[model samples]
Target: MNFKKKLSDILFLDIETIPQKEHWENLSSKEQELFTQKTLYQRKDEITAEDFYERAGIWAEFGKIICISVGFFTGLDENKMFRVKSFFGDDEHKILSDFKDLLESHFSKNQHVLCAHNGKEFDFPFIARRMIIHQIVLPKKLNLFGKKPWEVPHLDTLELWKFGDYKHYTSLKLLTHVLGVPSPKDDIDGSEVAKVYYQENNIERIVTYCEKDTIAVAQILLKMNNEKLLEDKNIIKV
Candidate 1:
């Protein structure tokens, strides 16, 4: 398979979110009591889904995009290089605004096909909602909501690996492991991101974690294309 044909129009994307926790704490006494009652756990030590939902709203506060990292990979003659650009800022609104700016002016203009692991379910919808909340228009190509499944150019790595078994879902890490991609032992996982964001307020850490995932996604793409992907060592901060 020709690498050029595979990567002719491709952009990989991922996002990190911190659901609304502070706002949930400000609920009135009556509301709080009702929420707690509804979320009571079956086991004394277990936390219920209700408890989590009551404590944290479904959506993060507008503008607090902990991380939104995107990678653009293409072939130049016989070589391929991926440029990963990111958007990170202390202010949630500013972070999201800058992300929207890049999507509209820089990323949105690219003709490349978009790819991600579980992007269709998580990243794409999350970004679309954020764009709508900010009133930022999505790029012409990315508006895949109403299109026929075959008409959409975006690819979800998780979806690709299911192979019609449909009994289980595979995570990016699991796929990378099975495919023999490089695994960094000290990499930050998503579970630790919210704590790192609110407790330490470390935007850089979040960015690094997000970048690692983007690279992992890129590696998955390379594997799918039956092409070799060189490791990128350059660290980007934005």
Candidate 2:
């Protein structure tokens, strides 16, 4: 797919999530039992299900999005800008609400699309599940009730890199490095997100991490199209 035509039309995004409850004990006994069963295969006999609970954030039912960072292109070349914005905080409802507002207001057009590294598999469905849980109306972009595979208005950079090889998977950090894009990982990576949010109680750090990933995603897209990557001066944080 030629990304040049749609470069300015995509809302590049990334999200950071944490377990809904701070600790494993915070879950109801029934929830705990379900969690154990849900993770039984992965957890195995090596680790107790409760011990693996920190990773519950990977699942929508047990996780909540703490932050959603988005970036979009604007202006012409030489004056081009990739403006970044974030909807985040303690309240998941407000975050989802505000993000929905963004989709409806500015990115509601037919040409507009949502993007992320592995969004179609994780970010997109996770957002949709949480929105349903919170009773938020699904935005047109996230609502994929009956759309055909090719009809979905979404893009995954990871998929682009796969080149139709389903078994191949590459981390966003690795992709950036190989493509000569600046590394987004100055501090914590995704594995440390839960700790930073829970133990450190530092949401701001997570926001910065998410935003950097957002920028990195856009840069990767430009690289794919053989376009020049944006310089620091060209990135505007909103």
Candidate 3:
């Protein structure tokens, strides 16, 4: 399928999430019981729910977004550049509120679409759920109620790469490597995000990693469009 949308209208993004608390022991007795019941089927008889808590960041109900990095194209043709910005902090509500403001102020148009590696199944829904949890209003792009599937402005690089084959799953690192795009997982991967956030308390590193993933999503789109990748100098961090 041809990508007819203008690159300038696409907002490429990535998010970093960690479990709501540092450890299972941090949860209240009632909360722990609820989590255990929630994960009973998934964990089966192999491990206790507490033992599985480390993987909770993958679920919106048990996780909190710490960083959201976004990138957009500016200019046209050879003069185009990618500008990246990040909203991150220990306060999940503040991080999400800032992101919501950005969407409302700039990317709320019908033509504007948000892109991420696995956004549809992960990032997109995660953000919407967290926003609801925080009682923040869902941005136009993320509020899909009453809208047709086609009307929702969401683009997933992984979905684009699928080409109708739903059985295979591809990671952004592998996709970038195969497409000759720069790899963004040199220093850290998604699995390490929770540990880095909770154990190391390094929000800056997580922000940097999120920004790189955002840029990689944009690069994947350029590759799919047969456009040249942006040079390092063309990526501006804000």
Candidate 2 achieves a global lDDT of 0.93
Q: Best candidate, lDDT-wise?
A: 2
Residue-level lDDT tens digits of model 2 in 1-106 = 4655567899999999988998999999999999999999998778999899989999999999999999999998788899999999999999999999999999
Residue-level lDDT of model 1, residues 21-46, one tens digit each, is 43455566775565556555532547
What's the lDDT for residue 200 in model 2?
94
- Per-model TM-score, in order, reads 0.78, 0.97, 0.97
TM-score of candidate 1 against the unseen true structure: 0.78
Q: Write the per-residue lDDT of candidate 3 for residues 88-202, one digit (tens) a residue.
A: 9999999999999999999989899999998999999999999999999899999999999888899999999999899879999999999999999999998999989878989
Error of 2 at 74 (Å): 0.3
Instruction: List the RMSD of every prediction in angstroms.
Output: 4.3, 1.1, 1.1
Global fold similarity of model 3 (TM-score):
0.97
Q: Name the lDDT of candidate 1.
A: 0.66
What C-alpha lDDT, on a 0 to 100 scale, does residue 224 get in candidate 1? 70
User: Ranking under lDDT, best-scoring first?
Assistant: 2, 3, 1
